[model samples]
Target: MFRNTKMRLGGVNILLLTIVISLIVLYRSTSYCLCKVSPVEEAFGQPMKSQPRPDSGEHRVTCHIPGLESRKQFYQYFTEKEYKCENLRWFGSRDGRKAVCMDMEFYLVPQDCHVLSFGINNEWSFDDKFGAMGCKVYSFDPTMGKADHQRSQNVQFFRLGISNIKGQRKVGMGSRFDFFEVDRYVNILERLGLTNTTIDYLKLDVELSELEFFQDVFRNTPHLLRNIKQIAVELHHGYHGKGLNKTEDITDDSSDMSPISTYQIFWQYFHELRCHGFKLFHARRNGRWTEAVWGNI
Candidate 1:
């Protein structure tokens, strides 16, 4: 009986060892393994749902800003935080009595972001709460599968898209958040005379391939950042080891998006956000990590 028990223990050890080795292999081999692809449309040019995503991804962590260790603290995955907020128009507390924090430089969003959906996953939840006191909320997902309209109560949705660039490759992605490049979004806002409006909250959940679109915005549209008191940006790293097909091979087009991994693009952008005076106060790794930060300056 003792021999048999020892044999069982040995088997369990071996199983654990195998599992650890597999995880290490996958992590090193894959660029951003946590991120996934849409089976329906690899580029997801159609509306899958209508939930406004404050930033991106499903997993997140939240803590009372100016938190006290006397209480307790820990991390939870695949869970959500109640976007408790008063209308942005009201002169009230920002986060909760305290703010949700990140680990970076420490920039907390001044307003609540109730995301309805992002990219192809459009039917999630901003379903819980709607707006903040003294704040106006809007969603710019091209994945809405429409032109212009109101999606939810106090929620204005727009479908104008950037695709890739001004004259780069275009998609049938009329409104389904199927495009890349973010400069066009800025251009649209500029034209609307809303460029100067303070965006207490904003989210960018576009796939990793278009991460450069954000870098371009911070570089060229620094003024736009002034309006955004806080941002829930989702910076995807790699394409989960999935190699992208070259445009030249697929369509022989010279003005196609130069294929690059999401990691290369997003890492550069993260550095850019840092230089802009925002700091990270919270971050959690789910399929992807969703973090909350606030501005120090």
Candidate 2:
């Protein structure tokens, strides 16, 4: 009877050990299945979905201007702080030369208006549109081959380029042409008996000289642009960077000039205009370029 009891107890002990080992194996397998990470999770790694952008101050240590690192950020600042797009009326072609912004107030003006357009690359659609609206438009361009002045119904085309200069200066490598500075052009307008006249609309599309022209205007004749109702300009900064591509490139060869990037200089001039009470209203992107419209309102 003693031997039989011992044999039964031994069998029970072995059965209990087997059950415990099976439970431990099952537990380990389940734990491993839960811990195995998915391929998508492994690739994402950084948790971009859950985290905020570091530049937005959500993850930064200190606060400052966030949108200045890349082109995306630059435009974010342009649209948020610089551009004031409200109740705007887009006119002309969506992708043509006649494109412009005609605010409600300007669109309903009873009296005749005047336009000073710079850099006409053989496209007079904008000038023609304004002229049809009874606005006297003057187009200036030195690249028109001849200095012969041409006139339409209410629009006049002069082979004269606008800039900030003391007198007439010849431009171009060969077959040069004379270009007028801001003061000279204003004086010419005065001589033409348009004294105390306010330019209702100012349009500019100078290939790469727009920055220099702006600097000249601000440094010499800031008041020239003070009363302008609206200003539209196309910026060409897609080449090597922003600002005049040729100017920035040749700056390295010049001695009297500093090595400051043209992009930086452009921002400075642009801010100066803003400080003078010009608020951006529209921005149009054309591939690598951008056209911006500014108004006092």
Candidate 3:
């Protein structure tokens, strides 16, 4: 009887060991499968799909050509062509303030995404929506009355401005009389320890300063352009807008190019952006300016 009891105890121990080993193997396989799934897929339990390109039978306009001089030509070139983004979606305001391509590779792993939003004049809808989408957003606006603080769980607000050059420079907040100190885009990135990080989305609404900022990026730091995935900028043309009247001419850094009007510079900037592999995906008219979104092709 003693021998039988001892044998039974040994059998129970062996069964428990086998069960533990099998459970460990099952857990490891389950973890491996989970790791293979992307965050978007995990959230939906399926691959994120996009709509097929609409067969509108419309001939798409060719971009990056020179000699877009006239206002009519510029308007036609920008308005006629819309790049086919399969998963294009509007975020933020109900009026379609911001457009983001959801099918991009960056959206697959949204937790690792980062956005740099410039020129938020108290409109937090864009930043807030992006933050809620699991992207870490860094919003900068020197004109906003609030100081640098955490705007939300994932949004960080800074009292900085995008410029061509580094260091503090006075920029018009609302009018010619109201001015605030601002910093350069590269300088701000360095300050925020994001010089090497890939920017998933870059939102620029710096009034007329975008022209100078684009010149600086294309001329000096063209390499930085490679690290950016998407760009949404509000392009201001002519002298009718508030920023055109308040902000100074952006000639401080454009010594290489010949003298040109803001109209010519605007087209030139679009050309340069096209040369750098960015294609216009969306464009919307907002009063006197146009809000254009470009995706890296």
Highest TM-score: give the candidate number: 3
Give the candidate order by descending TM-score. 3, 2, 1
TM-score of each: 0.47, 0.61, 0.69
lDDT tens digits by residue: candidate 1, 1-297 = 999999999999999999999999988888544546433224335432333333223321122232212101112211333232222221113221112223232233335432222232353233113343213445555545666566555556565444334433333311322343233545556554565554544445544424445654554344445455545544443233334422233232222223353433444454455565555443434364344433433
Where's the lowest-lDDT run of ten residues in candidate 2?
A: 58-67
lDDT of 1 at 297: 38
Candidates' C-alpha lDDT: 0.42, 0.59, 0.72
Model 2 residue 185 CA deviation in Å: 5.0
- Write model 3 residue lDDT over 1-297, tens digit each, in one string: 999999999999999999999999999878745545434235435642322212111322234658744566667767754467788887788432688887755363567889999888788888888899888999988877789999789999988888776556656533542456666665677777777788989998887778768876665456567678889988766543354343434343332122344667888878777877788878888887788988877
Q: Arrange candidates by lDDT, descending.
A: 3, 2, 1
Task: Write the number of the candidate with greater TM-score, choosing between 1 and 2.
Answer: 2
lDDT tens string, model 2, 1-297? Answer: 999999999999999999999999999888845654433335435221222223222221231222223344345545654544445654445443534455564463524788878776777777777777888888877777756465787888776665555345544322333344333444445544554566778887776567657865565345556557788877765345332233444334332123354444555556666766677767767776778777755
Task: Output the lDDT of residue 229, model 2.
Answer: 76
Best by lDDT: 3
Which should have the higher lDDT, number 2 or number 3?
3
> Each candidate: how many clashes?
51, 1, 0
